[model samples]
Target: MTTNAPRHIISLLMENEAGALSRVAGLFSARGYNIESLTVAATEDPTLSRMTIVTSGSEAVIEQIIKQLNKLIDVVKVLDLNDGKFIERELMLVKVKATGAFREEMKRMCDIFRGRIIDVADGSFTIELTGSGTKLDAFIESLDKAAILETVRTGASGIGRGDRILKV
Candidate 1:
């Protein structure tokens, strides 16, 4: 397997309105840069939105991406979480087969991972989990591949660890 590239978590504050997100996405697409994951939502300030994007590249490529983002009209500020201490978390909802012998094992695994069974049917269980991306990946790896029916993930959301803050 190929070794993973260095990943960077980029957080930005931008105007909260139609087309803003599209513009940011377009910038990456135009440059042939791949965005591993992206999440955006309106912040407490109605006029602003917080977006978190995960990508991997060399130092020079990352710097260029940041510079280009800063030039966008809707972008107010950009912060690279890797530059300092930051806390990151992602949310995932996974639905898996939970019948026969698999049911008990699935429940046990969820308990071990601190995941909550949010929904249950006769043959399936939907679990809600929140943690670092690595933790989430481990949870998936622990399960039987064929057992996983569906999964929804909210990309990594991050913030500086302490008094450091990103604001316009």
Candidate 2:
């Protein structure tokens, strides 16, 4: 309920079929647990999909969530990335005002964040950046709040580092 609650990144493998995602999401909603972010995509296995769910709760709460997820009919496997060493990333596309004096400053800010100006318009520039959620947030914070026009973020996706792998 609060930001101080420990955040958890739960990765799950499930059947790549209609309603699988809905069921997963529904479970969280039904339990009144808020999902901070969720990213789902078909994995290399045609029959399976990988879903990364970001949520915050106490250790007990996270344990309960994982147990409930494992009981789902569609879920094949589940792993909490926080349980071990892992790498996480999120993608953000931000459109900012790029006119007059703002243009140079915006470009400089983007370069500092290692972001790419993927699109340019008469008065706006769209930037693409990839990194951990904190990094993305820092990039946004570095900008003038009024300069931000629109932003889209792909929720955090993560995997265990090294030999740790979640496979069917």
Candidate 3:
């Protein structure tokens, strides 16, 4: 994962106002940076929104992103979760078509991976899995022999391990 570039996995907290996400995304796109995955949701404090962003660039570019993001009017907080103590998780919904031997094997695989079989029909099964990104990838890779119809992922989201906030 080392490309001599700055790969930042950051989380931002902001007001649940309109256009705020757009503004932040626009800032990155305008600068030609890449957003590997972005996930946002309303926080426990109902008035706030949380955004998890994964992007990479040279060290200088990351510093620039930190500075520019702070300048955005609606960005209330910025957290560098790559700081190494956060608990991260992602949700993935995978649909795979199963027939004959694949049907029994698919169920077995799901059990082995601790994934839930959300739906099952004569020819397909929709499964749901939640865990760290790497675990999810491993699950998906092992299911490659089955007929994969579609997959929708919620991207990585997390918080600090303890009661402390990313911002005190």
**Comparing 1 and 3 by lDDT, which wins?**
1
lDDT of 1 by residue, 7-50 (tens): 99999999998999999999999997769899999999999999
State which candidate, 1 or 2, has the greater lDDT: 2
Candidate 2, residue 149: CA error in Å? Answer: 0.6
Please name the candidate that would achieve the greatest lDDT relative to the true structure: 2
Candidate 3, residues 13-68, lDDT tens digits: the string is: 98889898899999988987778789998888878899998888776777778788
After superposition, which runs of candidate 3 have C-alpha atoms over 4 Å from their true positions? 1-6
Q: Which ten residues in a row are the worst by lDDT in model 1?
A: 1-10
Listed in order, each prediction's TM-score against the native is: 0.96, 0.97, 0.90
lDDT of 1 at 111: 97
Candidates sorted by TM-score, best first: 2, 1, 3
lDDT by residue (18-97, candidate 2, tens digit) is: 99999999999999786999999999888999999999998988999999999999999999999999999999999999
Q: After superposing candidate 2, which stretches have Cα over 4 Å from the reference?
A: none
Clashing pairs in 2: none
Best by TM-score: 2
- The true-structure Cα RMSD of candidate 2 reads 0.8
Give the lDDT of residue 92 in candidate 3: 95
